[model samples]
Target: MKSSESRLGQWPLLAEAARRDRLGQALLLVGDEKGCQSAATALARWRLCEGSGEEACNCRSCRRQLDAHPDMRHVRPETKTIRLASVQQAVASSQSAPLWSPMTVLWFDPVTAMTLEAETALLKSLEEPEATTQYLLTAERRDQVLPTVVSRCQIVHLQGSIRASRPFRPEYLADRGRDLQEDLTAAAEAVRGRYLQRPDPRLLELFDVLVEAHGGIDRNLNQELTRETVAMWWRQTVGPD
Candidate 1:
């Protein structure tokens, strides 16, 4: 896997923000987890770096960030969900000044994993922006995130080249009929191939719909309904052939 700085180079808007020191206090990065993580780390390094360009400088702050700086705080859920205690800790940390760097970064990966109470607590901090602090939130899917939290931050959608090392397989349809499963498998492969080739917004949207439909099936949703949803997404995104 590539570093966040290297991965972020493909995104012009985000790269420009980091390089020009124009990044906002709150940022909601939506897309693949790997890319989002790299972008978040790249943004943090850019903010702390003393160099003139967008890339990280060889300054003390940049060096410390590379090695995990003390001022950089990471808030992650211990279990499957983020607790309110974690949000409180992050909020408290945001109030303090940076120990070494010019700015303090609070990175929350998979922000959608946060519980309602945790999100509420984090919302309060976002409402009152801090000058010397930056909040970076990454989500694999945007729709799963709270609208209020989404509204408080600048949203960045990232798309990177999809590696073909792992081919598409419809494992979620294991309990479905064999024929239906075979059809879905073929559809999944087609969508995956198109996405790998182009990686356009339409294909990304279709991919998100496929992921949601898979989750819907796991939750005991109507199999026919899920199948229809996937079919609709395929028609709308990829169309015929």
Candidate 2:
């Protein structure tokens, strides 16, 4: 029930939640990485700040020993998505006592990308509460999560880092991807469209360049070299005209 505006023009709306004693055992923070992390860090700091006036802080929760933290377990995705094995390990570790703080935080940054199976395995832990454990799950979008899982926690919206998008002239060619051939083909179509509008011989030459690259694919030519050729051509083709 907080406004869209961020706290300090950066952090998430966590003041109201903390004031009302409504920071749930399982909290779902929805937004960009920076804001959600700021809120999570604020929560951690607030808890530790009570005991330590300053440094020599008896709160040994966040001292980075190699890769692990004592009272916090950050469950990161293996590659593109969180795996069931990672969730299971965090769930199993959830039972252990917090070495420093009163509660332990198990954080999953942007749980939206979690695979169906991984989310299912995590769903149980979210639904069931542990007296000494706090679940901090983040997401870029709320819709990415399972409805049942979303229902079980206190949802906090955050102001993520807004980035300015690089301008792309051809709308169709804007969605270029890793596949060099696919993007080159789209660029060729872009050039054809340009030629239709302006009747430029240069565009026809660009179209031929893309076609020549496509031709190489049939000959089992070196893709990396061909892609580099197209990239250099594209760079040289743009600007001042």
Which lDDT values do the candidates have, in the order given?
0.66, 0.62
Q: Estimate each model's TM-score.
A: 0.60, 0.55
Task: List where candidate 1 sits over 4 angstroms from the true fold.
Answer: 1-8, 19-21, 53-56, 65-67, 160-241
- lDDT (10s digit) by residue, model 1, range 1-241: 1133442455544543444344568888878878887777777776555554345346676656353777787877798988899888877886878887667888887798899999998898899967888898999877788888877877765542222223333443343554443344344445656766997878756655654453344345688777667766665676644
Question: What is the lDDT for 192 in model 1?
Answer: 50
Number of clashing residue pairs, candidate 1: 1
Measured by TM-score, the strongest candidate is 1
lDDT of 1 at 114: 93
Q: Which stretches of candidate 2 lie over 4 Å from their true place?
A: 1-13, 47-58, 62-67, 160-241
